[model samples]
Target: MTNMLVYFLGFLLLVFGRCRTSLGQYSSDQCSWKGSGLTHEGHTRDVEQVYLRCSQGSLEWLYPTGAIIVNLRPNTFSPAASRLSVCVKPAPESSGTNVYLDLNGWLRPLLREHEQAAGLVRCFGILEGALFIEAIPRADISRRVTAFQYELVSDELTGDRPSPAEACHLCNEDQLLLAVCTKDFVARGTVTSVREDTKENRTSINVDIHRLYRQKTQVFVPGGPRARRWSGSITMPRECALKVSDDDILFTGTLRFGEARMGCATRYGDFLRWYRRAQRLGTNPCHLDTD
Candidate 1:
């Protein structure tokens, strides 16, 4: 998608579901999410929200990071799948580790020290009678960036497999993160997933994914002069909610999760238009899902 298209679509997302919005309302009424180990703590682990939709017989939620595995395979459960298994490993060093065996797809693993990336997920299935394995680059917010500016890249991001002989390199996880630290929390990325199986009688992963997601609010701060003022990007949790002033005044407004990060035409005005737009909306419908 064009950058403009992506931003515009994101704008629409920020504006959806609000019928009564005001310019200066501030409340914790619009943001929430759920997952084990997910946190509001700055620079710690992030929350990954997913969704799935299907008939009453369908089952959703797959993939390793998000699943419960038994003996290195996704678990066989009440859902009556041909089989299911989930697994997690230190980013692997070879094609020998078939991540697809866990989720039933061909995935190449790129092992960055701080962030292991699978540059793409190769999907295959037999439909009617034809079979295909199509490779798609990983484009999600979290996994897409395997390298960073200003950081030493130990190894270039290569598709399919990690080079055991090459050192891994990644962006400084905290550089962008530290830019937008609030007194008590940090904003993180969103996750959307889809899974599919060919059998019509069975619950497909993709169909199941649709019902599992609800939109979530996340926070971020882009770098500029504002970044220099802060000692660091991370907002370490403190008693009684760490106190920090929101100089931009945008944080005081009732903005949804992803809306606060966009920049306007000029460096200064982008945040203003974005914040004003956010303030104009109220009470995102998905806040409660955080719990």
Candidate 2:
């Protein structure tokens, strides 16, 4: 009788333990399943494709993985619409491994209004991996098709080139104006020298200032060292690195790391003209709806 009682108690404990384990597994699986659905037009569907319901948000894998191939298709109301802009970055908690996704080359076709439908589809080959995607709608025009579709392919991609940080720094006119307004210094300068120190893994550029539209008083002097020439460093991966030649006029913002940084504004031919107009008006032209 004693032996029977002990056996019965052991059997009950084993059953209880299995039940608890099963419940935990079920909960985890449910969460993963829930994240797989696509939310669209006030309805959610459990679809294989990942869907972005809003303009700005992050997209993550339903199940954690090391690498993935993403097929993205963005739908706009019209071919001329320019509302969707997407950027991908590694999640804050992700490993130090580089996350590579080509945005400029991939997004160009989609952004062009007259491109063929086939050319607009973007396929990300393979990445060390990314945890989230950030999407923003640049145009004020109402977006009829707000949700975009994406599918994940579970293939490990090796030997693919990693994209430089500069490639992901694409910003529209409004964003550029916002940076200019908020930055401590905005200047038009000519590149005097570009030095890439391979040993130190640093890239520095020396600029000869032509004019200063803005500057902090403490750092500004009527005839100080910065009045003539200023030096700043840029951080970019060795691959797809930036090259600047002497006599290149750059519209730069000095908010990044307290150093002047050049971006898309430098590439525009009429940026300086527009910037001067904004200065005279004492307003951000990008902020005005007329722009």
Candidate 3:
């Protein structure tokens, strides 16, 4: 709308003060303006028109606040789709490919459903220059698999999303199930030599732990190729409650920054310390009440 543009121009005036020079910079349209919302009356596909001109990987998002967030990066899983960022796994596990729906697209709805970060209807932030809703989506995803996509046939997406309790790593029943229960968890005994699959038998108690104190920061500096040192018995837990298997586990017991973070020699010393005591995924320690 002309009026909206005028309002924006005024907003810019407030931000930048007066124009730099009084030369020929001002256009006839700028001299006198009236408010009018975007008029696409003659346009057949207006949405595609305005958005098509931007970069290939970017997405334009209009917020309720009259602000917009543009996604500067392409969707990692599918570059063709719009995305904020891909949660990648570390070195050894990095080779595996997995993807999750960007929370920027689905989080608000999910949180409103679960009442986690409610009252978030009016929230805004810039991620990579593009505006995005700052809300958490209930990403109960286990493995990377195409979401069950189809035109919405029902109008009931307004409440809590369907229960996403099933662990669905690897597109198979065995791995999926194993990723959930403690069954697949393993350990070795010098004496008993027992291989216990706690998968079939396990008990889970959601301990909403609030404060997991920062234990200690271990520096993984230059020590050559021997930088990584796992303590507290490092091995795939006999069973993983992580249903999303195919999707790379960015970090396991500890945080794992992607290669970018790995390659920066200058920052390795600093990052190493932060990595030593990074928090991990599990039940929320302090559940932020939404309702």
Candidate 4:
């Protein structure tokens, strides 16, 4: 009876060991699906599966296990390089590690092949495994620059992933108001001419200033030098290939780095309304400079 009892105990131990081994394997499989600490082609691979989703006016790449999504807006600009920009944020429950998306290998080709269908396939780069899509005009593509420019905007997961409704809100009234309040320079100008400087590899937009509501240091007087016609090239990323046409009224902002940025004011009247609201908010948005 003692020998039988000892055998039973041994059997229970074996069963427990098997159970632990099975659980270990299961845990490994789960982690492998999340791409934990895996490397591929010299890039720290964190995505288990990558796939694209398309809707009427949006294209998105979803990584189920990675808990990340990249959504590209439809290209509305007539020029190839003028594309709708995409904003990426981390999804809830994502690992705090930086994620990497390789654009050159699979994404670039895919965009090029379906350029027409995709609309704006200018350029893309990974920022902490999040993707920022910039429009690269056709002219810039001829330069044969193999490397794409990417800006790492943030490190921490701010909040929940932006829903489709939220993603579609680009340069809305609230955004314009925020830009006017926060940005150093804000103005309305007409694009007199657009030229590309091959030597500098930059696009210059010659604008006839219409109105100035904000500047960093100098104040704008009607018909003053600050409000006069200005022609200059912005020191923006080459991937931000902005295309302006003659007589296009652009709402412009200047970054602290002295880079001029413009976005399409689709609702021009609404933008003006918001701009007025921003002006009343405080004196922060009133300094004007033509740097």
- Residue pairs of candidate 4 with colliding backbone atoms: 81-136, 81-137, 99-129, 100-129, 122-136, 214-287, 215-287, 215-288
Please report the candidate that would top TM-score against the real structure: 2
Residues 1-291 of candidate 3: C-alpha lDDT, one tens digit per residue: 999999999999765432121111121322211111122222211221111111111111111111112232321324323232222111221111122223434433211212221211111111222222221222331221111101111111122122233221222322222222222111111111223335423222111111122112332222222233221212222232223222212221221121101101112223223333232333322221112
CA RMSD of all predictions: 26.0, 17.1, 20.9, 15.8
**How do all models score by TM-score?**
0.18, 0.32, 0.20, 0.31
- Across 1-291, the per-residue lDDT of candidate 2 in tens digits comes to 999999999999876544221111121322121222112221211112232333233333332222222323233333322323333322323221122243532421222212211113233332222222212222221221112223322121112222455444566655677756665556655555567757434455555555556664323334424546544443332442355654445354432223333443454345656656776887664442223
Better of 2 and 3 by lDDT: 2
Clash pairs detected, candidate 2 = none
For candidate 1, what is the lDDT?
Answer: 0.22
lDDT tens digits by residue: candidate 1, 1-291: 699999998888655522212122111321111222112222122223222111111111111122211111112224333122111222222111122222333333322233323322221211111111111222232331111111001111112233423212221323222223321222222112222222211111100111111112333223323332211121111211212322221111112112221110112234334334444574221121212
Cα lDDT of model 4 by residue, 1-291, tens digit: 999999999999876544221111121212111212112222222222322221112222222112222322232323332232322322222222222344532332223222323222232322213332222323222222111111211111122223434333467566665565565566666555566756444455655556665665443234523535444433333334445654444364543223454433333456655555665786334433323
Instruction: At residue 78, give the lDDT of candidate 1.
Output: 40
Off by over 4 Å in 4: 1-169, 197-202, 217-231, 235-250, 263-267, 273-291
- Model-by-model lDDT, in order? 0.22, 0.37, 0.22, 0.37
For model 3, the superposed segments whose C-alpha errors exceed 4 Å read 1-66, 75-165, 168-229, 232-291
The total number of steric clashes, by the backbone 3 Å criterion, in model 4 comes to 8
Cα-based lDDT at residue 53, candidate 3: 17
Error of 1 at 178 (Å): 19
Candidate 2 minimal-lDDT segment of 10 residues: 21-30
Show model 2 residue runs off by greater than 4 Å.
1-168, 216-248, 254-264, 273-291
* Regions of model 1 farther than 4 Å from truth: 1-92, 95-97, 101-268, 277-291
